[model samples]
Each structure stands twice: as C-alpha cells, then as structure tokens.
Target: MALQARALYDFQSENVGEISVREDEVLTVYSEHDIEGWLEGVNSRGERGLFPASYVQILRAAAGGGAAGEPPASRYANVPSVPPPQPQVAAAGGGGGPGVGSTFCPPPHHLQAAGGGGGGGGGGLVQLTALQHQASGSGGDDDDWDDDWDDNSTVADEPLSGSGSGGGGGMRFSPELDGPGRYRVSTGAGGGRAGAAAASSSAAASSSSSSKSTATVSRNLNRFSTFVKSGGEAFILGEAAGFVKDGDRICVVGGPHGPEWQEDPYPFSCSIDEPTKQTKFKGIKSYISYRLVPSHTQSPVNRRYKHFDWLYGRLVEKFPVISVPHIPEKQATGRFEEDFISKRKKGLILWMNHMTSHPVLARCDAFQHFLTCNDEKAWKQGKRKAERDDMVGGNFFLTLSTPPTPLDLQEVESRVDGFKGFTKRMDESVFQLSHTANEFARKQMVGFKKEYQKVGTSFRLLSQAFEMDQQVFSVGLNRAIAFTGDAYDAIGELFAEQPKQDIDPIVDLLALYQGHLTNFPDIIHVQKGALTKVKESQRHVEEGKMEPQQADGVRERCDTISFATLAEIHHFHTIRVSDFKTQMQHFLQQQIQFYQKVTQKLEEALQKYDGV
Candidate 1:
C-alpha cells in the first residue's frame, strides 16, 4: 500500500512538474525527492506532481505499515489553519489592483466564515511563506540579486534539507476569470491574469516596490499569451505603452511600398567571456558566471547561463513575430566542467550577436537594460519594466507602423502559407544536417584516429623488424621506418583535433538555425491567426451581427500583423544569406587548412624514405 499523507496547507503548482493540493486533501506519497523538503506524490484526484514535504503530514510510514514513528502532527502544530490568500480581482474596464507584492485579501466567503462560525465554508486563506536561506556574508548588492529563476537544486543527488530555499513558494497561482476551475500563475504582477484595462497601471504599481521585494515576487514570464476567450477575438493583456490610453487608436505609418526597417541608430555587439566558477551562501550553492561586455557601453557585467536563459525568455515574450534563437541546453551533470562552460559561452556569444544585429531587437528596452545595467537597483527596475510590458501577443501588432496602403488579404495569406511550408522543410533539413554533422565529428574523433594509429603501429612493428638486421643498409631503412611511423602517429592526433575547427562550428550554426526554424512556425501561425480573425469578423459583418466599422478595425489590425510578419520574413531571409555565407566560408577555409597540414606531414615522411 502507498504511504498516505494529508496536506496541512494549500499548495499551488508553480512550474511544469508541480501539482496543487488544497488544505486537508489526502495524497499517496510515491517517493521523496533527491532534494530535501520536496516529495513526489499523487493527490486525491489522481493528479501527480512534486509538492513540498513540509506541506504534508505523513500518516503512515511505508516501512512500519502504521503510524509514523515520529509524531508528524507535532511538527506542524504551530502552523496556522487559515485558507490560502485569494488573489485580488480587478474590476472589469477599471485599473487592476496593486502589484502581486501587495498583501493578498482573503475571499469574501472565507472572511464571513472567520467572522461568524455559521455562514461560509471551511477553507480560509493562509499566507504561505517560502523558505528563505540568507547567504552568509556581509549583506551587500549581491544580496539583491534574485537567483531563483531556474530550479537547479532538483538536479542534485544529495538531499539539501539545510540548504536555504531549495525550491518552494517563489511563484504564486491565482484563479483566472476564464473558468472557475482554472488557475493562472504569473511570474510577475504585470503578467498575471487580471482585467485587461488595468494591466499597465498594475505593472506601474508593481515596479514601485523596492528592489528586494520586486526580486522576490517577480520571475521570468516567457510564454506567449494567445488563449482565445469565449468571444471570437484573441485575449490580450492591457496595452504595454503607458502613453497609449485605453481609448486611443493607432494607424499604419509607412508608404504603399510596404513596411521597412528603420535603421538602428545604435549598432553594437556584445562579447561573452571568462566563465568563472562562483559560489554563495557559504559555498552551499555554486554556479558559473560569464563576463559580458557590450560594444556600446564598453563596461563589463557578469551574468550566468540562467541569466541568458531568462533574457531569451523575455525576448520571446516581448516579440512574438521575431524569431528568437534558443541558448545552449541546460546540463544537470558536469555543468562546472571546462568543456561545458566553453561551449555554453560560445553559444551565448552567437545568440548575443544575432540580438545586436537585428534592428528591432537591438532597440528593445528590456534587451538594452540587460546589456547595460550594472547597478543592483537599475537591474531590478529594468526587470520590472520588462515583465510589465503590455505590448505582447495581439497588442504587439499595435506597436508596429505598417504601410498606410492596405494589403490584399489574399496575397498576404498566400505569402504566409508559402513561408509556413518553407519553415517546415527548413526545420527538417536542419535537424538532419545537425545529426549528420555530429555523427561525422564523432567518427573523426574516434574511428579516424584509431585507423591512423593502427597504421602507425604496423609501421613501428616493421621498423623493429628492420632494426634486428646488422647490415649498414638496414640502419637507414630502420630510422626511415620509425620516422614514417612517428609521422603517422602525428597525423592521428591531427584527425582528433580536426573536428573542433570545422565540424563543431558547422553543427553549432545548424543548432542555432534549428532554434530559429522552430520559432518561425509559431510566428507564422500568429499571423495566420490574425487573418482568421479578420475572416471571422467579415462573416459577422455579412450576418449584420457586427458593424462595418468594427470589421474595418479588425482589418486594420490584421494588416498590421501582415506588414510586420512580411518585414520580419524579409529580414530573416537577408540574415540567413549573410550568416550562411560567412559560416561556410570559414568552414571551408578550416577544412582546407586541416587537409594541407595532413598532406604536409605525409610529404615530409615520404622525404625520409627517399634513399630507401
């Protein structure tokens, strides 16, 4: 029988692998996590996920098959029996409540129950405090940096019970208006599901909090918010631009020729170098930090792989149509090794290069802040501003200045469909190329090296045989044979070294494009979705359910998306040509150099046997 436990406090699911459990809910404990203070269990409803070990009281131990040896009840005896806090709801068409950092108010029914014992239900809102482990050292600017963006602790094999805040209570979940049963968890106050009208105001309020408080409540909200509501239109958070009022409207600004990119005023690049091993909290936690220096600023800032991951997520959220390249994969094991760190730093460099080159992405406020911010206070301020950015999803189109001349919807649809097919084929081709290149690199390192070594070994053995002869003529032949053997051995080392120069760079470039290819389809879909909405609006107009003016507004929005997408597609093509041309040139040059060295060594070996 599975060990059973009862939840003492309401637990909310924050990340992908966690499950939410209400107070008093029974759970079947599957196993304890490698990280202490967490347990893998299935709740009463059969939903399985990782929850805090502290939240549940184990009624029976699996070994004893009865009550736990230690009284579990006493452990949580002092814990409050209050219900979880209900997130503040924004009134429809009005500004939302204060930032998520503000103290949450309990539900009306819970309040009634607390006041009088007869009216409301049993559940009451309780404040769940996350485990906080203060880093050991003089409190300084380092203390203000929030490093909980990624849950790396779960990867450890040893249970870290005493380690500060292994993984609980940073992200919070609140009930969404779409469904009574559905819950929405926001990494920041601006990203939360609230009244659309109040999104910008709420973000401003959220930014007003102190740096430390902002760091504690906010995280990276990197996902696209494209959920379709009961209404035919797509759901969008309130406008991100503070200047744009609730009722303000926008029009396309370019000429009939189509949308063109405004030249980037600040064209600059960034370098990622010096991946240093860093530790905190008296060495309980350790991570690798990269030195980042932007060409525009010349000042260097230290960032971690997680920081790049967070920045990548922000770029994705901020620009849905733009193809954001993925950073290197996160490795759980051997992360601190030199090879892993070097590869990661190189990937970051490439990713940053692309960010700097793009006119639109280069000018992004969040990105600028990431590249330049060195002060702790400024970092938090920039983070909040990025999180609260309202110009995402459908609203992102609102920020674009499209060609004033209306686009032919049919032509736009055709172009979008063609690009969609291109991305699909490109994704498959890149995957195949990446796989083949990796295999070829592996063979060069192992198979080719071994083959050359085998030949060298045979030559050396022949030299030994020649050495046995006492004749003067045999002496020269023996020396030549040994020299040839040494040359072959050197060739074997060259084969092992060759892949790093040519094949690895090709594979890395392919991997980057593969990430871009993956992003393109979604971006195209977003454009196509807008077209679909336009078609729907036209149908409604035909049926007289919607006015012509409303349909026109829909058409304008659709046109905006089309123009932006077309411009981005053009940009992608241009960049693809330039990147492939440069990379292939370098790849071919390296390949030639590798082969020339091999031939040069063989020629020298041939000269050694000239007399023989």
Candidate 2:
C-alpha cells in the first residue's frame, strides 16, 4: 500500500519557528524545537482514565513552555543581553531560585538547621548529581580520552585488526573462550578463534582460583559486561488486587531520600500493612482508598532499585488513589528543610483543594448545604452523570495538526519600531483579561485623573458606587450565597462557553472565588482598602511631597485594582456557581409547575365527564 503523507504543525517544537510540512517531517520531530501549549480542547474532549496519544503530545508541548514564544529581538532591545535561557539561568544555580541546586543532594547543615532539624532523616540521602550521572558511560566528556590504549596486549570486546594492534573504536563484544591456557591474539577482522589451533589454544581462559592477571581480568569483565540501566521510578504491583485497602502490603522506591517503603532491592517486592499505610496515604492519596503494607526489608521495596535507582511504591486499595509525591523547591530533600516544609505545606493546600473538588465530595457538600439551608440540592445528579458519561465516551484528546503563530514570526528586520500597531494591540490583548479590566478602571476613575488621565470615567463611577453604598452592597452577600448554591450550573455554563483560546486566565480567576472568598470579607472590602490607599497617596500630594495632580494617579491605581477585583469576583460567581444554580432551579421549578397544571387539568376533565 502507498503511504499517504500528511501536513502537521510542528507545535511540539520551539526552534523550528512556525512552519508547515509533510507528515513525514513530524517523524523527525525531536523533543526539542516543538511548539509547547496547553491542549485544553484536547484534554476537555478526551476520557479521563485513558488519555489519548494526542493528549499526551499536547501535555508534553504544554510542559515545554507553551505558546509564549521567545520575545522578538526588538522587544529585548531596551533590555541588555538576551536573558539567559530559563533553564540555563536556573542551572547556573543560586542561593534560591526555581531550578537552583536542583541536583539530587542535601544542602549544608546550617541551611538544614533553619528548616527544622529533621523531619524525615533519610530524605537527606544524596543521589548522583545530574552532571555526574550524565558523564558516566558517555566516555567521560572529552572526545579523545583513551588512557587504557597504552597496553596493546590488553584484549577488548571489539574484533581486532592486524597482528593484535586491534584497537579502533567500533562495535565491541566479547568472544566466549573455553579451557585454561594463554592464547595468542588474532588481529583478524573476525577476531574469533579462526583456526582449530587458536580455538584449542585456550587463551584468556582461567583456572578457578588462578587470581587472573590484569589483562585476563580486564578481558573477563569486558566479556561479561552487560549494561543494565535503571529505569525511572514507577510503581509495579504483583497481583491484580482489588481496591488497595489500609493494611494491605505494598512497597515503594525511587525517591530523593529513598523509597518511602525503602526495602525492595533492585527487583524485589513486599507487602504493606496499616501504620505504614497510614503514613504513606496521609494527604497523599487520602481521596483514594489504599493501605501501605509493611515491608520486611529496610532497603527499597523493589529489588530493581539497585544503585542510583529512584522510585516510590505504596500499597494502594485502588488504582486512582496512587500518587507520586514531588515537592517543587530548590534543593528539595526528604528532610524537613524550610523550603521543603514550605513546599509540603503548599502541596497539602493543593491536595485539600483537589479532594474538595472530587465529585463525591461535591455531592456530599451540596447535600449538606441543602439540608442545612432547607433549600433544593444545589447539584443536579442526573445531569452531572450525563456530563461524566459524555466525557468518558467522547474524545477530548484530539491533537492539533497546526500550531498558533507567534507575533515575532512575521518581522525579519531589526529596528526600534519593529512591531506594527496591530501587533502591539494584539500582544496587549494577551495580557490577562483581568489585567485589562484593571487598566480600563484606572482610566475612568476621577481620583486617577492626575495619575492616569487617560483612564475612562465609567470605572471611577463603579468605584464611587462601591464606596457610597458599601453597607447596602453588603447585601451582595446573599447573592453570593445564592450563587454558591447554584455552583454546578454556573460551572457548566463556563465549561460550555469559556473562550477556548485564552481559558486558563479565566479558569484561574474563577478558582480564586471557588476557594478563597472565605478569607476575605467581601469584594467590597478589597475595593475600600484600595480607596484608602489612594486617599493616603493623595494626602502625600497635599503635604507638598508630590505634585498636586499626583493624587489623580493614586486614584486611578485604586480605581483599576478595585474594578478588576470586583469584576473578577462577580465573574467568578457568575461562572462557577450562580449560573449552575439558576439553571437547575429554573429547570426544577418548570417541571414542578408543569406537573401541577397537568393534574389540575385532568381533575377538571374527570368532573366534566361525570356531569355528562
């Protein structure tokens, strides 16, 4: 069959610059130079349990730093030398930075003392540094380092050429020898025992307790050199057990300090019991049912966790409960270092949010709210089930054949004004929508006239309205409650209508309200604080420390922040909670009303029939 070639966008790369090519070109697409982006559409469309290849590709692209391509050279003109690549800057290593000291090791003791003497002592075990690991088996960096070549008598696995001067780098392997005798070297291309005499010569053979000489030892090691690299850490279970339950035996391996179960040597297995299971599952996979079985060995649970191996194993009750723990911090270790602790706390926060987000949790919470408030259930179970079914059946994991074009792709020349007017506008639009709303507010606020004379006036009025009727505005609290009551409906609307192109920013804003409003009194409180700050800055102008119109600048700043915060809070309520409630409530009310009217009509018809 003739192969049909296809064209696809090299979205998986960064270096190629945006271009189109035949499908075969993609076969050569390396991890480098691929377009990176969050394939939201693909993820949203695909089933949860089994992500499609396209979904994986999109995720890889997203992880590779998504669509924010390298800035145009002109954009960097005002700034000095091109900012070092992010990873390189991180690699250069510093006291504290995202990727600084990412090498697997423990920091100085003093740094450790600051964090809390020790949380988990083994977490401090250092593994091979990144550079050290990369250097091994790659001929140790220098292209021409052959210290072992001086001894021509030395036999290698490679076939020899000409009278034992057989050293030239190529396919190297050892020929099995038999019997005990010193054999002469054959420099033939097929450097095996060519003649029966050579075969019977029994060279490179050894007696049981012979204490093999240097040459013989080298030959023996080389002959048996079977390189087996340890695969990256992962979980493996022996049997297809049912949901992993507490007290079930399980093993863990491949972590920075050591495997959590730390008993399995390279290629070993063990069972998990209760106490250990409790430790492993704490905040880790609490949402999932699982138990970490006790390990009889103190080493890693997997025997395959040989030297330099990293993995984590746990006895999980179910497949979904298993999780890989990773803390993002400089020089992270199992120890309770400050950064590690901070990250751990952050991880806990994230986990809590995740658990609360579970459908089961949501249903329970919705039920609780309805029972407490004597209101209808906020979430519609049947509708939610349908949505889940659709998600499971439909493919959200479609891979895009093309990638988006960056703003810099068109410009070839270097100049101060390299960017066109529309390009600038478009770039500005990419700035998060909330930021744009804030900018809009700054322009309108009257107090911002001196500071942001260009701002619009509508924003200023909103801020003014907020300040004057704040107590009354407090009534918005009930609206918020109502909105929260209808969260599922709101989420559905947002999920269905959210702009596909720039949804992350919107999603982020929505999340803040879904989780954080309890921390703040109300959106109005945020606005009032901004107003106070603006007034303070205006006081500075009155004191002659600043220009008379500087007060306008402060006001503008206040107006923008206030407006953005309000808009975001309201938008979040509208999308994540209110819409859902409103929709579901309307639906239920309509059904109830319809049934009532139908019963009334039927009764009247029966009466009329009786009279007849």
lDDT per residue for candidate 1 within 188-269, as digits (tens), equals 1121112121122333542342221211111112222232211012221111111111111222234344454554655898
Once fitted onto the true fold, the runs of candidate 2 whose alpha carbons sit more than 4 angstroms away are 1-286, 289-522, 547-553, 569-581, 584-612
Q: Give each prediction's root-mean-square deviation over alpha carbons.
A: 16.9, 32.8
* Tens-digit per-residue lDDT, 132-178, candidate 2: 11211112112222332122342223221111111111110111111
Listed in order, each prediction's TM-score against the native is 0.62, 0.17
TM-score: model 2 vs. ground truth: 0.17
Q: Candidate 1: deviation at residue 573, Å?
A: 1.1
Off by over 4 Å in 1: 1-258
For model 1, state the Cα shift of residue 479 in Å: 1.4
